[model samples]
Target: MAKKVRFYAGVEIDKDGIRHTWSADAWQQFMDSCKKESQAFEIRGRKIAGQCESCYSPAVFYMHLTKSRELSDWPEAGDASGSVSNLATRRDQTGIISILEYTYLLPVSGTPYIALLRSSSGPMPSAIADWVSLKSDMPAAGKSFELQPVLRNDARQKLNESLGVKSLEVRFEGKPDPNSTSSIERAAAEAASTIDESDYANVKVDMSISMGRATVVSNSTEAMRKQALSILTNNNIAKHPIKDMLSKGWVTKLKAKTLQANPESDKPIIEPVDFIKEHLTEDADFGSMKDDEMTPEIILSGMLEAIGKFRKRSNEY
Candidate 1:
């Protein structure tokens, strides 16, 4: 899988009622400085929020870095063995410091639809101890952020300068699927062709199963499309896993039904026997068996054996 590069910053307000924003550059500089000073910073009371802006359809994100940490390690330099002493001999220490942030995502001028993030945060003073003792007074936000970070191919050239990351060429992992348009715009244009209702229904059910939730009832086709896209993209479901799940689930359901059927009857149900016979016929060794050789007793034994093998394979997967 290709790795994605993301830019982030901290925003905060000080006790003196002054607000500050830290750009991605500033954050990177601070991190470098920390490394030079042989110290580490820890995030405290981290909170994040996201909302969709109406006009440009831009995504707005907010984050609060309530506190910071100053960390120090003992024996500043490693011993001759290139290993530091154990915890008993080591003197590691850290302290919590004050910091806060207010982040904004706004549309960039000229690029009417594109969103640009401006992050602000308070500065950390060097006077603070590298390993001062302090208690955490920040409250937990108790919320999670679920937004997927999107890096548009078009914006790569503009962002590469300051971000210092190379632009990634959007290349397919394998030969493009000939059945579907390889480009999003072309796919959208092609989708105008009439589609079967049964196909739509199957897609809805598959999306619901992939998300592990019931599909939201919606009258709008656009809404349904968005829901399905969100589930598929965020979950990153591959084709093989989905196909495997469907096949296994189908077999499991059929096995359950077969076991439940004819509980009151002395003889076994025909469904399981038929299922076993179908599988056995697929085997090269068993394919040579004549119809007359498959007696009722043989069928029952084959069904039991098939069921055992099916369960073992299922467990492995």
Candidate 2:
């Protein structure tokens, strides 16, 4: 499967300490400087080992994450002749690991877009920000920069969707600690004391209820279930209990049902890389330009165009 790229927005503070979004012009200047001075930069106290390849254009750069470190020893493993042996530790031995990763940067009039190839061994967003900062124009007093992911709307949309709940079932089971200062805990303690002070320490609350639009069904004690739906929905029948449970963390087991005619849309969460690729094509009409293999210049051009389209979508929304 092809790897996906995660997107981000670049924000920078100027000498006056005013925050501003980076622009394409800003990115262009940064990349040009990087091309001119593509020396190994330090991150996490480690510098690029050797032959640091700095591939850059107006909007992108390939970060060669090569590092050298002392190799103390190797674990017991079979050699080429198929004989297992415990390798001895060698403090003087050193090893080098090389990794090639790409990050695309394209800033609009506002914040710039940064797209990075997502990989298990790739640098994190914060590390990427630091890497870019190193290549950035010499910092003025108070000047700094940051890179943040362009989050998907799924989380917000899911909150509003509310599973289109038609019914809700909740089960709460646990003993509240007597020492807890929470009002709920105190209420539980009081109820346990009323049941039997001798057994208060062993008391537990096991309550279950199922609520529909206009009716609630439960065999549990009336007081325990009383006003539960009200407490959850704040007297709003149209609201779902899930929201309350999420906010309060009071509900233990939850079973929610939606109308069969209008079933809830529980779309699978798209991976960051896949999400970006699909949007690039759907929203940006990014076609053949998304080639499997291309020259550095071509890749930069394609990414630059795609980012512009993304900026438009970002503005429209």
- lDDT on C-alpha atoms for all candidate structures: 0.24, 0.40
Candidate closest to the true structure, highest lDDT: 2
Give candidate 2 regions above 4 Å deviation.
48-111, 137-140, 152-317
Q: Indicate the TM-score of model 1.
A: 0.18
lDDT tens per residue, model 1, 1-317: 11111121123334453434444553344334333222223323322222222221122222211222122221143666897553324433223232223222222112212111211122111111111111112123221112222222322212212211111111111111112211321232234223442232122111011211222222432332333222211221212222312111111010101111246864333211111112111111112354435322333233333334333432221
Q: For residues 1-317, write the lDDT of model 2, one tens digit per residue.
A: 22234455666867886767677677656655555444566766645321223445553344433333323323354556787654433222323232343333333434555554322223444455556666564363557666544544642122223323333343322233333323344454455555543333234444323332422223332332222322221111111122322112222333333222223443322111121212222112223543545445654555565556566666332
Candidate 1 residue-wise lDDT at 278: 20
Clash number for every model? 13, 1
